[model samples]
Target: MQNFDYMTPTRLIFGKESIVKLPEVMRSLGKRVLLTYGGGSIKKIGLYDRVNELLKDFEIFELPGIQPNPKYDPSVLDGVRMCKENQIDVILAVGGGSVLDCSKAIAAGAKYDGDPWDLITYKVKAQAALPIVDVLTLAATGSEYDCGGVISRTETNDKVGYMDPLLFPVCSILDPVYTFTVSKKQTAAGCADAMNHTIEQYFVADSTLLNDGFCESMLKSLMVNATKCIENPEDYTARAEMMLCCTYGCNGILSLGNSYSGWPCHGIEHALSAYYDITHGEGLAIITPRWMRHILNEKTIDRFVKYGINVFGIDATLPKQEIAEKAIDATYAFFESINIPMHLREVGIDESRIDEMAHHIAVNEGLENAYAPLTEEDIKKILIESL
Candidate 1:
């Protein structure tokens, strides 16, 4: 086990119609607000109107069209400006993880004088931020319960993960029914994202039995319910469990008191998404199995063996190396079985940026201390093999 300090301050109200309490939550944060969302999905599903109706008593300022891999330009910059200009008291993110992510930055940026990127890049820690409240519409990213969000810079092709204790939502309302329209592809990708979150923690060199069981249970739940969610989008039980799994995915609960693995998949996929702007989770799915195979060693094989036998039920009698290899195969096959494209080419990532991405990871993501300690050359090889 590793030495650690942990805290999650976000209050979760989960269930059907939990969103009806939106106004009450907002009331605590004051009146003027910035309503943030992505490109019109909420409108299509009548959530836009419902939110407008619910906030009829409070002043509303709209910030629309936030994109996935949420950009820092219009969403964060514009939202920060809006909050400052309108005297906005509370920030409500009304879309998936991307929108909520953008809003979290905006909530902090509104209070800062310098560029928000300074806070995001860790040039300065965010000490104070406007309170954030969320009505989650997707079962991915777990941005609601976490203080970290990934923001993209189109100008530089950089996607940076920003974390601050001040950025945790004051309250999050999770209604599983809101995710009923999530496409099968997104559902699978979302589950993959959460599962990868667990695997990242599970692979650590320093770990505890408590966290290991938490990660394994989360992995099993996501793998089992993700298919049910895809096959029947309206299945409330599957949707509820999967949503909760994702909400708990990345907030350090599954990794509490655990040593870091340096999150090697993230170290690689951040380059892929930052370079080509591919979907974050799918990029992770593509690189994960390749990473596992590349990093297999006696030092780490025992973890893979445990994962194989415990999570996937591979026979414990198998040889250690074969068991580890089988675990990697099962991982790739699970993503394939869910119909996710398991290669870079399938997701419009071409060869021109391989060197560029490798260099970026070398300079930006710091892969030197990864679970397997990948250098730029090793990263290039992993990318090539994944390709």
Candidate 2:
């Protein structure tokens, strides 16, 4: 096993009626609050009213319309401005990963004297950040539990994952009931996102059997519960399981002794979402299977065989290459079965910017050092294959 250090400081208030604790949690943090959200889904689901009722005693400021992929310029800049101007003591991010992600950047940026992009791009390390509390409405990205957020710079078509210890939320409120109204498309995409997170860690070199089994179990649970969620959006059992799976996805716990994967699928999909403004999870779903196929070879075939037999229940006695191929095919079929686009063109991407995206990913994402080491050519080939 590889040597590592792991700690999760974010306090989780889970299950139904967890929102009632919001007042106590926020009061412990501060009075002046910047409430952040995406679009008006919270309002549609009546979460906005509930949160407002809880925060009625505290001074509140609002920053809404934080979009998916969480753009850096307007959302981050506006949020930082709101925090600084209002002298906000804490941030209550009340939407999905994007809202919490933007809130994190805002928390860091509000304390800095320079541009927020400096902290986001790692030009300057954060000394301290405002406290963050989140009510998670989406079960993907695991931003509520992790210290990193992927922020986009739209002008440059750049999506960067920024991690700072200070960015961890002080606490997170997770009520799976909030996700009961999530659309079928988003639920499937969230499943794909969480699965990719585990697979990324599982495929790395120097992983322990314990960690591999943990990942395999997570994948199976996500697949089963995701289908259940799609069939009946309000199924509490499925929603709760899926929510917990996503919560554990990107945090360091699942891969404590595993070697770094370099997260190459995320690297490539970052470019896709940054360029096309597609859903982050859908972009990952489209790229994952193709990347899997491209990276498969004699040396890596054994890992695929294990994944096939363990995760997908493929026949163990099958020939080595066939097992590997079946695993890749199973992955593709799973995504397709969930109604993911399964191709770049199906999501409005074409060959026009394939070279550009490949070069961008190679130059910016550092995927050359990934477990399977994708070069610019390798990235282009995967993009073409995905198309």
**lDDT for every model?**
0.91, 0.93
Poorly placed runs, candidate 2 (over 4 Å): none
lDDT of 1 by residue, 32-87 (tens): 98999998779988999999999999999999999989999978999999999999
Candidate 2 lowest-lDDT run of ten: 202-211
The Cα RMSD in angstroms, rounded to one decimal, for candidate 1 relative to the true structure is 0.8
The stretch of ten residues in a row with the least summed lDDT in candidate 1 is 363-372
Q: After superposition, how far is residue 247 of candidate 1 from its true place, in Å?
A: 0.7
Q: Write one digit per residue (lDDT tens) for candidate 2, span 1-387.
A: 889877889999999989999999999888999999999899999999999998999999999999999999899999999888899999999999999989999999999999999999899999999999999998888999999999999999999999999999999999999999899999988999999999899898788888889999999999999999999999999999999999999998889988898999999999999999999889999999999999999778889999999999999998989999999999989989999888889899999999999999999989989889999999999999989
How does each model score on TM-score? 0.99, 0.99
Error of 2 at 100 (Å): 0.7
Off by over 4 Å in 1: none
Clashes of each: 0, 0
RMSD of each: 0.8, 0.7
